[model samples]
Target: MEFVPEEGKHLHEDCSTLILPALSIGNVGQLVADLLISSMGSERVGYLDDPNVLPCVGNDAYGPFPQGDLALPLEAYDSPSNALTIIQQRSPVVKGMMIEFAKNMADFLAGSGKKHIVVLSSLDFGKWQKVDMSSGLQIYYLSSSNSNGTDENCEQLGWKKLQEYDPSQMHWKYLSDLAEGNVTVEDITSVEDELEEENYYASLPFAALFSFLKAKGLKVTCLLCYCSEGDNISDAFQLGDAVCKLLQLSHPTTGIEGGKWRVPLSWMSVYGPPPDVSIF
Candidate 1:
């Protein structure tokens, strides 16, 4: 009830898009947003949780909302860099706060026409164990990071673009771009500590988000691409890689395939009809 649709607008008609893994988890979604010409649904106005806890201390923040509880939002992205971040916002985790925020988002979504809530996230080998705290289920990851949704990278990679960017806008990016398996990682050590563990990892933001979206009667799905977490548990390479594919971009070839892209003529044919067709 706190959500106000635009005048002349129906609550069920507005499409709110979410870019995932904003802090520690949203690297992939950020890339897709930039290339696809999409943006964060609405840069948050207030945050349910406190900042200065961990990773989000430097990257994400939440302030007072003159509007309402629904307005207390978690706004990510401070730099001129535009990757649609779904950052975890912290290291020690704050799933409860994020869940509260998601609850508010879901309530808003409940009365709206959000066709689909596409969540972007990747599995951190460590959190993977916690989110599932499992009895032995192996998770496999495939990173389509280099496959471009379209040929947008040709424009994104130009030196001219990077030069004009504001440094503050892209703080998480430099690290995310760094290949996966670069961060120290560990697996879930206890099931009883699931809540405590996840709070510490806070990597389950995507799943919680999906659940919140569903609670609001929204259709939701999570998309992922594996990161090269070979040794590093927090590496977002796969997420980053998958994002590139979603947006159809290429990394400047450092003779690397994970981050670099090479879209083929055949790939372009996947979308349009037989090269020549104007349907009435």
Candidate 2:
């Protein structure tokens, strides 16, 4: 849960907003993070040193060629001009260690003087019940600053507030209790073992992160969409666009496809090497 800055590189002092991806359906959040980092040309500032996350390493995800830069399980990038600090997660937390991870992250960000957090994630489209077709690709949001209603800006942006977030409900209350340090993981496990009700939000990593960050008195907003597992690059672009609009970040005009965004070179083989042309 400690932050290890790269040699001669440190967290941006002016960056107050932290954009993070909650490893969820389609890994849309991570993809959006990739888009933001690549397009913005953000610099890697530091990485999280925590044992709770499963270890992972791979080629640098942004470069056009193999630069020998290793991508770790959790790394932080800073965009000073945009006043943003984005965290890119390439691995999931260890089983039963989510709460501890969330707590540590909340503490770390709070101590780091972060003022706002924007969490990007996705929902299972099969589980989503679309009620309004007119809205078109509904983006649902849950914010600590606007729990009772939608934020005016978000409303203007055509994003809907998550309606299922009732803290009074038993399943949701359990998470709040846990985030506030009033309940332990064992207590929750025992309670959940007795309950037969299945709660979707309670099971996602975003829920824990949101609750913990909110408990730390930081503004947290979760932007979510509904999509199933498949090629979700388009979903990532849409979410990335929404985030840019939400944060008022100026889109760099040097990217591909009319310069709206710069697609990472690592994405060239996203689906894996043209199906081995020799086999065709």
Candidate 3:
């Protein structure tokens, strides 16, 4: 993978923390990324060129109007004031290449001097066996950091460490071993065929990315939400606020009146135009 910098913008060295979304259920992670990028006024520094990502292009996502800036499959942004770097992925990796994509990302991030990585994703709400009515929406976290401090911090913020993240589970162990190079492709291919999609954690991009990032010796924290398909805009905003809390950043807001969260203009047509008013 190669990073092609924007004409005058380069990746910032001081922006050591990276926040990216894994394409997953509900596309909540992507929506949260949109909020963060727009609210923080992050500048697009470059884009990633990789064959693993299916190609896509669209008008600028965050602008109040179509600004003529093109968006790509994977683009990098930097917010110097916040000392943060963000990656917005507009396309999914090709099927059967998730691990390869993760490896490429791990290598690039490690080489780029990134100290911490925050991965955001959504899980199938149906997989959650229990629902707590008192809690509006439960957020789960899995950290690669050995430090107990990370857990303590998240706990203090009312987040639960993902209890399902047992690396000893057969599928989970397989991914761990794969990331550490203890398993061969032949071994993986054979076992993968026998694995069932019912093992929810193993199937999502977060699992592959987390395992690979951990093997790269980087501190990674994954924040996940559970939701069914529908309008997930509220879920995205909640998770976005959770992320800001985790990082100790203030809730960012655009200059919109009576609104704390900034919704990108591109969202207006996400579900297509509103029904014709005259039809009412």
Candidate 4:
């Protein structure tokens, strides 16, 4: 991975937090990162160029005005006021290269001296039937073994750990059900075990990232929101608010209470009204 820093600007060596998002279900994590980049007035400090990442180009998502200027697929930002460095990943890693991408990211963080890494992500509710989706939304956390204060921080913020599933038990139940329907015991035993030993309840990038971080003993924390696949603006807003609370970026006196998370102007054209259509 190659980092191209902005001309005449460099990342703060002492930046404490590294905030990023894994491209997950509903795109909630990316949206939350967008809100942070806009709300915190973060600047593009650099761009990461890696062969493992898919190529993408688009207008800046947090621009003050629609200038039609193009942006890189992966850009990095810094919020000095918050003492945080943010990574805005607009695309997913190329297929089969997730492991390589995670390794490069781990190397970058290890060399950057950042103390904490926070990943905003989402998980599919359908895979885990136990997830309570009646409340419309819920945020959970999973921290690496080396997480210094992330566990305490989540507790102080009242966030819960994502429910874990026992793959062995689940697999056994499935095998038993198949056996009752004329399936032979030998056939069931012959089936390769598809269950993972540790299920973080996350999709590809987030799960791969967590594995890499844990193996390297890096202090990484993942904040996940349970969501369905649809117009998930509400999910993104809730996730943004959760991160805001965790980072103490909101003010009680600013009228930025519940359900009032800030939205960037770039989202106005997200669905596109077509080039011929203009709003007066």
Candidate 5:
């Protein structure tokens, strides 16, 4: 619904595989983007860049607000989604430009004849940890499912994303008694819960997009690589690893030459300082 039909340009010959990552809080999406870019390269994958347009129903920032500029909209970087409080050494990556670019990419994937789209992500769950920031998070496997739950997605492509989370297994809740202090302990847990939920919802946009794709009969697969809540994990590294796994999962044994169709080559331009694959 958000995307306009036949708005995106064709980047590849045909059937270009797409991988979209969340690229926010947990860095799972960013990690996936980095990995796909590194694997695909720039020349091969075309970046979907769309001009400024009035939003479908929301503001250029997080979501549609009641009021504020409806005419001559501002650039995406100026939106609230890009605004971060400077928590540590990071800033919000999902802003106006990134989002529109993603939309254009969706247009390309849908109309450009590429039926397969894969979105990569990393997330956190509330699991108690002893040392704090050293807990391992559970990784979830969510595949897109159609209304019938038995379309081509299930038969050929294997679509099945909507799965219930087992709080007992996936939810990691730290006991309050183990807190370092009354203030720090409660603060940590609350922060963890917020991050966990945010990461989970971050994947929703892609899910929504995939659902849209399904309406058009396009097959979309979302691969999420979860990170532990407090392990001080490298989301970037995990993304790369996830990319390799996704590629393998989509197709077994056949390397890139085998027509596995890795992500388009836009990695170098956007995600700079590529990870030393050896380092991962």
Candidate 6:
């Protein structure tokens, strides 16, 4: 993997944080990265180009308005004022290359003098069944072995770590038995047991990143949400808000009635009004 800077540009800076997304359920991480880049008005800093990764090209998602103009697939951005840098992957990495990519990314970040790394991700909601939708959304953090300061800050802010579960444990067996019996929804105790089991069984991409960071003794933290597969725009918004609070990024209050979070201009046509169809 190679990072190619834009013409006449230098990436070295006193960057305090490096933010990126891990491709996971609901694409929540990618959406959060998009929100950060657009809301912060970050500029194109560079890009990661590698043959092992899938190639992608599309119009700038954060453009002033949605258009067909083109941009790189994996681009980097920086907000000097906030002392933050962002790496947004518009597409997923090719299969079998995640470990290599993660290692390269860790090396790049470690050499950048950045103090923190934040990865936004999501987990499968079906694995657990006790979602308290009325209590507002919940987000959890996982700090790297070297991130004591980050862990303390999260604790001070009252953020909880995600409850882990071992897939091979009795809890999972019980859940499986229940499922076989057509009992999709179990008792609260069973659900709690399922959700609270302590284990790390993240997807390959996330695991790769964590492994690389741990091997290099780098400080990193991950903010994650429980999500199901589908149109998860709401999940994305909630996670975005959590990240904003954690980083103190400028953000408005939640709720569409109150004021919705700013979505990228490129999403305007995501569902399509058809290029020929007009509301005018």
Q: Which of candidates 3 and 6 reaches a greater TM-score? A: 3
Model 2 CA RMSD to the hidden true structure, in angstroms: 2.2
Q: Candidate 1, residues 1-280: lDDT per residue as tens digits? A: 2533333432222224334443333343434433222222223322324332233333112221122222122333211133232322224335435444555555654554445455654444443332332322222221112221112332343211112112122221211221122321122123324534434322245544554554455555455433333322223334444444444434433223453332222223324556445653
Worst 10 residues of 2 by lDDT: 251-260
Writing each residue's lDDT as its tens digit, candidate 5 over 170-207 gives 22122111211223334444455564474454324444
Candidate number with the higher TM-score (3 or 5)? 3
Clash counts for the predictions, in order: 32, 0, 0, 0, 21, 1
lDDT of each: 0.35, 0.86, 0.86, 0.70, 0.38, 0.68
Q: Across residues 22-50, which tens digit of lDDT does each residue of candidate 3 receive?
A: 99889999999998888888899999998
- Weakest 10 consecutive residues of candidate 6 by summed lDDT: 250-259
Which residue pairs show collisions in model 4?
none
In Å, residue 223's CA in model 6 sits off its true spot by 0.3
What ranges in model 3 sit over 4 Å off?
147-150, 252-259, 276-280
Q: Name the TM-score of candidate 5.
A: 0.44
Better model by lDDT, 4 or 5? Answer: 4
Cα-based lDDT at residue 130, candidate 2:
58
Q: TM-score of the candidate numbered 2?
A: 0.93
Compute the lDDT of residue 233 as modeled in candidate 4.
Answer: 80
Candidate 4: segments with Cα more than 4 A from true spot: 133-136, 145-150, 165-203, 251-261, 274-280
Any runs in candidate 6 off by more than 4 Å, and if so which?
66-69, 145-150, 165-200, 251-260, 274-280
Task: Estimate the TM-score for candidate 3.
Answer: 0.94
Q: Sorted by lDDT, highest first, which candidate order results? A: 3, 2, 4, 6, 5, 1
Which of the two candidates, 1 or 6, achieves a greater lDDT against the reference?
A: 6
- TM-score, predicted candidate 6 vs. hidden true structure: 0.76
